[model samples]
Target: MRKEHEEFVDSFEGQLPPSIIAEIKDTCPASVTKEQLKEIVELTLGLYKHCRVNAGECVGLVSAESIGEPGTQMTLNTFHFAGVSEMNVTTGLPRIIEIFDAQKEIKTPMMEIYMKPSHNDLEKVKKFAIKIKEVVFGDFGAEYVLNIFEQSMTIKLNKALLSERGLSSKDLAAAVKVKSKGFNMEVGNDFLTFVHKGKPEEIRQLYDLREKMRPVKIDGLKGITQVLPVKRGDEYIILTLGTNLEAIFEYPEVDISRTMSNDIHEVYNVLGIEAARQAVINEVFKVIESQGLNIDIRHIMLVSDIMCITGAVKGITRYGVVSEKASVLARASFETPIKHLISAALESETDRLTSVVENVMINQPVPLGTGLPGLITKLK
Candidate 1:
């Protein structure tokens, strides 16, 4: 029975895609006769041929319209991530703009860090989550006392904050001492005293020192602003507010295979351009899905392909994918027409009028679809 299916798949090798062929073979049951399987394959091939786009189709224009039409319905509201009120992510139209523009610095950079099976215990994952949170001095919930007379700054650390971060008073003192110069650190039960060893006339430095202490990162990975251990399915995963892909990948317990950052540029830098391309598609689809729209995936794939065709991710903006067009008129038609025209004129460039926009500007049929072919007649 398996041999019969294999023979059928082999006979339709070039007609059907490898993936479709494999699916048909794998999904067909032994109870189904050879004739039924052949009929199913024939129907699938017919649908595939019918759905395929014709040559010279203006796919770029179609894709733009497909995405833009649905984009009008998207909201401008931000959404709470995974029911975590503390973390709000930009969504709807704004997020779509951010993705398509290929913005380097996003509003809310985040990471979904999956854990290895060996370290996937609830308590262990919780500990791992806290271990990566960026513990700045401000997070300590410390009360500051500034004394100009003695040129001393004292910080009364909250015991709860200390225990949660797994830092002792001595560790805090040592961290402060290492961060600041010419300061004598005295560690007590729940407080640390910093006495400046510099000139007494520099008493104003105490105020500066007090303010500087607020942002001091005493422990944990840098750029990880907040961490939440959330259970997805049967495994516990860590979701972070800020992204630090390089540092996060260094951890042993992290399932590096499945871990990914929401920052597309970070993914490009860390995992290369291919991953960035996939990230673009995924991010765009996520926004569209969240808005309750059901656009075809092929349109999204086409957009991503254009963005990553140059071996680097470029946005759909004038300065990005638009600027790379071969036709001067096509570039001019997009934005800043006078600027593009003047630049081309100054550079002594020629407009071949190869694409749709350029030919349309000249009152000629677009070089696409039925207009793609030229008719030549020999006069008698």
Candidate 2:
């Protein structure tokens, strides 16, 4: 920025946050005179002051109402699969509930895998996508024959499928050997013969081994069941059905900085608390926007801030963010009132009634807005 612009912006440093002032300086046109710039900064400062919450405003309640009211209008549709073959994704109210409750296992964990610029070509991206999808013995198996007379299991492999997956019959035999213990394996041109080494009376073990060996992962990262390489604007990116952020980050061709996962806990584990907080905001906003709700972003931001304030991502449920409340009544009012009351009684806890719910429970005004100030009486 110019020296004059810097000086002008510096004048409003204390009045406004440094970030806001810097934004104003960066946004203002250089053709404008110092007086014009001053006017702009003052106007921005005035708007900022006007938008700020009052000292005693009940922000939590307001945010709750703002988010909760519109939330009821959301659709209850669970899986809105775009196409017959496309992956199913939990959407609308169900997804919102999943997000707020911070469910460890989500219905559908999806990821958008962006590639580095050089590796985003059509063929390369397609190959990368295929390479990342979890391939099992079942995917390559052409035929399975169980011979009870000989107590042996013969598996025929599809050469075309194996070649497409960049695997050979030897790879399949090795996998079967590792997975199916106590079985003598012999690799042929495009087939494997497993002779049961266990007792002949336990012939059922061969059939069991055949079924178990079908799902063993022979190639690609685990948990990635499906991958689709799509052209997004000028770049090609892969959309996956499952999410394994930590495992996926190990790929050199992946653009880790731009990749995103729908699983909030996975994001937290891989990228830390801040990224998880942003993920919450983005996911919530996405649902709200998809449902055509016009709620303000600040309310969502406040909720996200509260969820992430303790240096971890927590849900809005009783066992999560609500459990951290200092007030016993506030915690009780949320859920399991009797349980909270009993616990408080056992601990010999005192309720000062400093907050809203506890004060309301006793028919007293909440310590907010007009009730914030206490009257001082002078004795003669």
Clashing pairs in 2: none
Best by lDDT: 2
Candidate 2 vs. truth: CA RMSD? 3.2
Task: Flag clash pairs in model 1.
Answer: none
lDDT of 1 by residue, 161-244 (tens): 788877798887766675667777788999878888756658677777776777888889898999999989999999899999
Provide C-alpha RMSD values for all models, in order: 3.4, 3.2
Candidate 2 stretches greater than 4 Å from native: 1-6, 17-40, 78-84, 374-380
Among all windows of 10 consecutive residues in model 2, the one with the lowest summed lDDT is 371-380
Under the 3 Å rule for N, CA and C atoms, how many clashes does model 2 have?
A: 0
lDDT of 1 at 13: 87
lDDT of 2 by residue, 1-380 (tens): 57877887898778999889778877877787888887888888889999899878999889989999999899988654455356777889899899988889998899999999999799999999988899988888788888889888788888898888878899888776778788788889898888877666677787788788889888998989988888899999999989999999999999999999999999999999999999999999999998899889999899999989998889999999999998999999999999999999999998888888898999998888888764223345
